[model samples]
Target: MRTTLDFTPLFRSSIGFDRMLNALEAASRVETIDNWPQYDIAKFGEDDYRITMAVAGFSQNELTITQEQNMLMVSGQKAGEDEGQYLHRGIAERVFRRRFELADHVKVVGASLVDGLLTIDLKRELPEEMKPRRIEIATGEKLPRAGTKQIETGKQAA
Candidate 1:
């Protein structure tokens, strides 16, 4: 059972939140959920993150990781392998594609495959203009007192 959500009201009042609202709407209407190649997302530090995917038989050459604007995609396709004779096979050898929506400043750092696990590292690097900055307060500066004026001592003709 899938129910669609109406984001028209949010779009009408929001200016730069269109992508976020669209993501929410798309998540709500997801009917087909694929569980192949299970993955886990973990946060290490304040701006560091890692995604680990279980890929039992996939080699590094057969996998691909792509990153676009605010989006990350990981796909794996099994290479052709010869099977002599198999009475019963429990391992899965199918193609899988996984996508993850990234934040504004999130970037993929590196990736590694070890012990049948594919790990992808990500780090959120905010631009220098967007990072927090301290405003310096000037010292040794005095405000001029109002209604204080020096009278000029000049000769006035009567």
Candidate 2:
């Protein structure tokens, strides 16, 4: 049984969170999709992440990895190979496409395929402007403008 959630109320009160809400909706809808070619997401460091997928019998040439906006797509299609004759085949040789939603500032650094496992590396690189900064606070009273004559408060001239 599939249940649909209503986010109208949540959306009405939230601001600048449209992407997060959309991602939640998309995640809820992906339950019915095929789960072939299992994968794993692991975080090594504070800003470093890695995604590994099991892609047995898939060559590097037959696989493609693409990034569009905040979406990362990994697809693989095995080329038809002749095995002479098989009485009973159990291994799956099907095409698969997997997508991962990346957060803002997260970028794909590199990818490698070894021993039938495809590992994709990701790093979060925050812009200099967005990074934490220190603001200097004024300690003393405000200074007077330059080239301006200060009037004596105690004695006033007529």
Candidate 3:
């Protein structure tokens, strides 16, 4: 069976959700993504992420990493040489652009170029107010949680 989630109540309770919905709708419209210099995204912890891109042939001076709004963009372009006679040019020295989406509270730690790959590390430091807390349960008291239902099918409520 398929069930639909009703976000109407949440939308009504929130103060500024229309802009968020519009932003999400705009993000959904993004169908084409620039893929260059094969990359890998690895999760380190509950909020840590690392993005490593296989950036061969490009030097440290050519690679550029920037953050705008909520997106992390990386681009590279090699400088052309004027004193090169190419009789059999096979290597590609083209420019490439890559983008990575960042989650809320995530910040770019920095980037490093080692060997032939460029690695960019990101970390999400959740505030104390946002992180889950371990609450001690009382002997006969019940706790209420958000996004969850407490169903008493056969057990009696104390």
Clashing residue pairs in candidate 3 (N, C-alpha, C atoms within 3 angstroms) = none
Worst 10 residues of 3 by lDDT: 1-10
- Candidate 1: where are CA atoms >4 Å away? 139-158
Cα RMSD to the true fold for all candidates: 8.6, 7.3, 11.9
Assess candidate 3 and give its TM-score to the true structure.
Answer: 0.63
Every candidate's lDDT? 0.93, 0.91, 0.80
Measured by TM-score, the strongest candidate is: 1
Expressed as tens digits, the lDDT of each residue in 1-158 for candidate 1 is 65788999999999999989988988888668898889999999899999999999899999999999999999999889766788888888789999999989999999999999999999999999999999988789986668877877896978
Alpha carbon lDDT of residue 52, candidate 1?
A: 98
Give the better candidate number (1 or 3) by TM-score.
1
lDDT, residue 91, model 3: 62
Candidate 3, residue 13: CA error in Å?
9.2
lDDT per residue (tens digit) for residues 12-94 in model 2: 99999999998888777736667889999999989999999999889899999999989999999877786679898777778
Superposition error at 143 for model 2 (Å): 7.1
Candidate 3 stretches greater than 4 Å from native: 1-34, 133-158
Count of backbone clashes for each model?
0, 0, 0
